[model samples]
Target: MSEAPLAARPPAQQDPLPAAWPDHLRALPALIEAAGLVSFDFFDTLFIRPLADAEDAFDILGESRGIADFRARRRAAQAGAFRVMQQEKRGEIDLDGIYRCFDGLPDAAAVRDAEYALEQEITLPNPEMIAVFRAALAQGKPVVVTSDMYLRAPWFTALMRRHGLPEVPLFISADRDCTKRDFGALFDLLSAETGVPKERILHIGDNAASDIGKARERGLVAFHYREPRLPPRCKGISPAASLARALIRNHQQEVPPGSLRELGFQKGGPAALGFLDWIAGAARRDGIEHILFVSRDGHILRRMAEQVRPEALPPSSYLLGSRVAFTLAAMTPANFESHLPFLLSGADGLSPAELLARIDVPAPGASVLRDLGLGPETRFRHDQPEPMRGLLKAWRWEILKIARRNRRGLLRHLLELGLRPGQRVALVDVGWNGTTQEAFVAALRGLMPLDVTGYYFCLADSEDARRRRALMPMESLVGPDSVSPGMLAAIHANRVAAEFFFSAPHDPVIGYRDDAGGVVAVEDPGRAPTDGIQAMARELEEGMLDFARHHTGWTRRLGLRADPLGLAMPLLEEMADGSWADHSGLRLVRNFDSWASSANHTMWLTDYAARP
Candidate 1:
């Protein structure tokens, strides 16, 4: 076919080119119009396989052919063949040449046929470039294809025709025994055979060195069709990770500006928006009237919700409260004994007055401590003595008094929100055992009648959470069920980073108090320090927002809303697993919680590298 001049042949009638070209081929039309003849590089330039990489096709071949070792053998043989070809300076090797490298393999013909079948199954025409080819034909410009592949010219032409390309002159390195990579021999051969002036031919392909560089050396115009380049760290990973990286790259390419996908690139952006999206849907489904975001994790969540879907979601407010404050405010004499261990867990090495100060309760006077048979300088430990327990038991009434006073302050705060009795109000929070919600319910028991539901990103399957029928758990991509326990632990280890990212700039809630005027929330003294934590938090927030903005439109167009949970799982899993190497740079935070008294006394989260 190459013996005849492509320019001498008549152009074939074809359908008009697509009005909108794919991103990579947008420049092809102009390049084609400028040249009298155009040549396309086959393989990636005009076709792309859906597989993660080209060699993945061999794996499919091995599975289909029932030859478990075929893929490995094929790779070894190809590497050996390429070494021989490079040594010989022949520039290329055909299928037979490659097969000859595997001298010990039985039934070479069968193996070759299996590979051909696999290629047929995996090869797909790149529509964007095909449109460019068709456009060249319509514009009466002669066209041909040149490839560096080891496949024979006939097989290449046949595959092209099967994929809807019109028959045209073809030049392959294997058939010619010379490559475009060596001295531009293939281009010289094409010019000699097709009788087309090298200066008048334009070559368009993905490889800069072989196609563009070689063609340009031969005085032909070259258009580089750029493809996404994965970072060096992303390549050569496990297949699952490689595939994940490819999927991420594809998502980035398809994502529109200001969509969820774009926003998600910001740290903590996707999780925040995803949780809010789930909350909005839940509120709509359950007929919730008011949404209260529990501080301080809910602080950022509320802000994100307002920015992303203000109109679609119900009215929301940031309620100033936390687990520690609410748990203390809701304590009663009846439950005080059962909760004593938890309340005093963080009070190790503290004196009676200091211990009382920690919970923001008034410390009993020295005379009262002495009367209760306790010294002012007495220290508390994880395992309290019987005397200390008795002393705690005696102080229950005072604790209850303080709890009731704080409860009144909480009730007054809620009343100011103007929520009607029996209204369905949903409390939003970052998940765990739902202790804050439980405390809130206990505090408001007789003060007000309201149907309150707790909505969280994930609800821990703890005894406390199991009994709460009013708690609504939103399935998260990075929860226990979605990932292995080890992975879940890894995420928990990063809680400090997560919390820092999700937290607002304001101080933490201490407790509430009531005066003659009204209820007031007491906040911590100063802002959380700005350090590496803040930098990481900013990254997470920006990443999530960017991903949300970028991918939201694509998600809608692709009908991804049908299984939003499934769609979100992989991305979340990758992030949770720290699959991307860039995630290694995330600041590792060490969190020490004295409240946890399990056998594994010091819980480790984040800093997987530093884990003992």
Candidate 2:
């Protein structure tokens, strides 16, 4: 049965044409108006192979034949065949002639069949060029297709027909044993066969030598169809996608909505993947066997790490502890005196109940409150330190009791995770002052002898963080050298948003307590407020994963890997500067006192304002 006509098939998706055409193609209308006929060059002009590189089709063909080194062998054979053709000044070689270069190959016929099948799978008509063909035909202009490929004329006609193009007169190099590259020979043959005037015959194609240079030399009006160049250092899937992007942009058209989303994800996802890879590599290098991702902020990072490099990374777990939880749990009589500064710094005008809530502890019993000469109505003000000091002295004993219990519970939880003495462990968090690490180490001292290190995304240049880094080895993926001042401010101002994005679907870790089973983290029954923020976070998270998957595949194909720091720094900067996406109206209502106490107060209030 005959195939359906091009007009009878379903209309393909239409992409907007570019506003301007190349200088060569710009003369097409006048040439068509004056000419008796117009001819098109196949391959890159009329049809684009779905593969990134045409040679990749051979790789697929080899794989189908179960040849382990098919790609290398195919490359060598093609090179040899082309060299012979070049030496003899011949047009082209058929599949049989090319395969002759591989003398040791078994069942050459099977390989030929595989090549045909792969071609059929990867070949796709260029929709924009096809539209041009349709328009020319509508204008009563006769058109034909001429190609320098090894495929037979009948095969080329059939392929075009299958892709919903008119079955125009077809010419192939192998069929006539002469190519357009051989100067005037092919054009002379075409003109004699079609009875068209040489000057009036306009030919459009992608190759500069065989299509434009040679066609013009033979007196045919030639238009050069330039293919978009792939980005530098791009390989595998990236090259193909990047080329497509160029084509879309050159057309002065927007990409499809789905493609836009995919590209956005690609920008961010690779960074996350790169960072995870870096962390895994660092852990291995340092002989760190356990990775403890701190609660809330570490939640999404841990998930990304598991997805990207599950087997390559060391064992990981989410340790449910926050700055508030750890700091409060680490407090005691000896340290309470020192921590009084931090605790009371932002305590001005706070009621006794409110102050206790900030400390992650329940209000003391009525009898304890009475003994401290304080009631629920009493406010802790920084201006009057005497009464607050008296109350702290009275509450010191009870506070110590609570801290000791929590510290023991924390130790038990560590033991449950199989944390052993002298083992190296790394604590991961979105860093500020490294308070969580210090609090954790202080709680663990004399309780366990494990050596601990801290890995942060970025560390604030603060005295406390510096002191902690001096005593305990610490590293940051994003630091002063990597982030700009504005970007750092945006990041600092959006801590709540970051926490919401990274946190698990659970409540904050209030404290830890021993149970019949063992040490268990105590959590609030209510879930974090995530109605609006959840959707945004999920969109970003999904985009990151998708990009990572594509980037990782490309890296693997090219036998090279991307640097995590290089990938992560730019992404973080974009996100921080609000240049990534419009985050208007997204408010982080919760106030973080970390900003007030730290030296990094350059954060802009506009960053916190609702987007218009």
User: Taking the candidates one at a time, how many backbone clashes does each contain?
Assistant: 40, 3
Candidate 2 segments exceeding 4 Å error: 1-7, 10-268, 345-350, 364-394, 481-501, 524-543, 575-581, 585-612
| Tens-place lDDT digits, model 2, residues 1-612 | 342222222323443234465444576666666767778888878777634456656545654577767877877887888888888877787776778888688987778777876676556666667666665676667678888877677677668768766666766788777789866578877787778878878888878898889889989998777654322222443322332222222222222223323333534454455556667878988999899988766766787777766786788888877765676677777778887675666666565555555544566776777787877677766778766667666666766666777788787888888888888999988777787888888777778877888888777656777788788888876655566656665765544444433445455675788899887776543212333434445555665565555555544543343466655544464456554334332332222232122221222223443221
- Once model 2 is optimally superposed onto the true structure by TM-score, how far is the C-alpha of residue 475 displaced, in angstroms? 0.9
Error of 2 at 300 (Å): 1.8
**Model 2 weakest 10-residue run by lDDT:** 594-603
- Model 2 TM-score? 0.57
Q: Over the stretch 1-612, how does candidate 1's per-residue lDDT look in tens digits? A: 443346534454655576786666677767777887889898876776543567756655565566677778998898899999889977788887788898687888888876776576556666556767778887888888898887888777668768767777888898888888877899999888878889978998888899989889988889998754322232232222222233333343343333322334533554565667677788898899999898877866776667656776787888887776677666777678777775666555556765555456667788888887778778766675565666667777776776776777777788787777788898887766666777777766677877888887655444665666445333333455655666565555434445544665555676788877877776543211323433444555555555555445433432233222333344445445554223434324322221321222323333332231
Query: To one decimal, what is the Cα RMSD in angstroms of model 1 from the true structure?
Result: 12.6
TM-score of each prediction: 0.53, 0.57
